[model samples]
Target: MDKLTIIKIIHTVIWVFFNVVLFYLLYSVLINKIDKWVWICIGLILMEGLVLLLFKRMCPITVIARKYSDSTKDNFDIFLPNWLAKHNKLIYTTFFVPILILLIYRLISG
Candidate 1:
């Protein structure tokens, strides 16, 4: 592929890898409790949301991708404002609703 495509792939891979490692650490080490799995799951989901928001808004890799796309005339669009991109209320609600419900159920049942 071209330089732009290569850069985009690298950026995506790095972000995914970072998130996986971060979640692993959080679940395995930071909150080491069987009962905390619910909290861990919720935290991971929220972290994913935050990463999505960052990718949409102020991610350095996304900024680089935007620059490369602009220079090469690629069809990548990454020019979202920080507020709209990072704090997408709809996405946040959609992702967390199920997790919140599960957490509440677990708490009440247990």
Candidate 2:
């Protein structure tokens, strides 16, 4: 397989992994199951956030993918649809921020 295809597969896998983590976090908040895993999920997401900040808000994988493909479309580097690729951060952050806030409330109110 070509480098660009490989990178797209890897990036999509990473995206799905984070989606699972985020969903797990949401489930924890909904069910009031605050545990070590919840903290771990938050840590993982925060680390991803830090990486984005360091990379000027682009996924490092996407930056690497640029070397292999010249496509300017948002989903050029990954398997997501164009609109989702364009607004992925906004969509995920909408779910994450509130889940985070509720988790914090659960932690503090205990």
Candidate 3:
């Protein structure tokens, strides 16, 4: 009901969505032959674990969420800017960067 609660909910939702998307993309690229439902479940579990690790490791999103949650306290209208909204870009890139490099290396070697 309060602003902070609303902001926290929104932040959590966004983070969860981003995690799911990232996992789905990576799974599709690396495990395209797998069953969709099984991959989905695996991705969900992996993402949840990654989120918890991020939170424990002081990841930027977790840090921002903590700060916003603390600052808003009881506010609900917290709006994140584009940069913050794209905060997980680095994480996603980490998943793809090596793949890209490997592809490039194969092409060059061949």
Candidate 4:
């Protein structure tokens, strides 16, 4: 594997890892797991979203990957399915937003 391929693999691994943590934290929030840890996770998620939003919703690794290759194929930097790669944010946000809202309610009420 070349440097670009190695970087792509690292990017894919990090992306998947973050997603797993996000889902786990979101699940914890849904199950009424209220505490500093939940809030910390929420903060991390929001911060990450803000950073991505600043970059037009593209991961920094995606920008770097473009410099290495001109492939327009889906899953260029990740090992995800084409559909999942395309709709991952929409899919996760579907659950995350509401759970976040509930988290806020819990925080405010307590």
Candidate 5:
């Protein structure tokens, strides 16, 4: 309906897209289907990490969303629960790193 709302919606879409890609990469690694797509997914995630760093450890979308509304709700920018959204990076990295490391080890040893 408004510019900020549209931007918030776009931000949420991108946030969801990032998680979808991350999960798909995880699925590929777990299924032993790591291939070019997996590398591409990793690259995407790295770029996201870079963006996070650039934004002072906040997602660019989240920063942009701050200008839109001051809802202060966890799901304001993304579709995650309050607690999960707050700890998304830590939780995902905890799981993602080990799996990715194991997959990379398998790749390297093969």
Candidate 6:
């Protein structure tokens, strides 16, 4: 397979991994299950946020994928629907921020 395709697959996998982490975190919060796993998920998400900030809000894999393709689509480096790829960050952040706030509430109220 081509390098761009490989990057796209890898990026898609990473995206899915984060989705699982975020959802699990939400579940943990909902159930008041504050544990190491919750902290781990928060750490992983923060690390990803730091990496994106360092890269000027772009995934490093996306930057590498640019070396192999000239596509102007938002999903040029990921295997996702075009609209999803274009708004993925916005969509996830919308859910994520609320999950985080809820988590904080659970922690403080308990």
Q: Which pairs of residues have clashing backbones in candidate 4? A: none
- For each of the candidates, the C-alpha root-mean-square deviation to the true structure, in angstroms, is 8.0, 0.7, 11.1, 1.9, 1.9, 0.7
Instruction: Point to the candidate with the largest lDDT.
Output: 2
lDDT of each: 0.52, 0.95, 0.53, 0.77, 0.79, 0.93
Tell me each candidate's TM-score. Answer: 0.42, 0.97, 0.38, 0.82, 0.83, 0.97
Q: Report the C-alpha lDDT of model 3 over 16-80, residue by residue, as the tens digit.
A: 67567656655544544334653464556467558767677434444555644544322222344
Where does candidate 3 have its weakest 10-residue lDDT segment? Answer: 70-79
Instruction: Evaluate model 2: give its lDDT.
Output: 0.95
lDDT of 5 by residue, 29-102 (tens): 77888789888888888888888888898877777777777887766776567898788889877877876897
Give the alpha carbon lDDT tens digit for every residue of 2-53 in model 6.
8888889999999999999999999999999999999999999999989989
Per-residue error for 74 in candidate 5, Å, reads 3.8
Model 1 agreement with the true structure over 18-84: per-residue lDDT tens digits: 4464455444433333355545655766676687587773455556667556553222422334454
Which portions of model 2 show Cα errors greater than 4 Å?
none
TM-score of 3: 0.38
TM-score of 2: 0.97
Off by over 4 Å in 5: none
Consecutive 10-residue window with the lowest summed lDDT within model 2:
100-109
Instruction: Estimate, for each residue in 54-93, the C-alpha lDDT of model 4 and write its tens digit.
Output: 8899877788878878878767777778787788778777
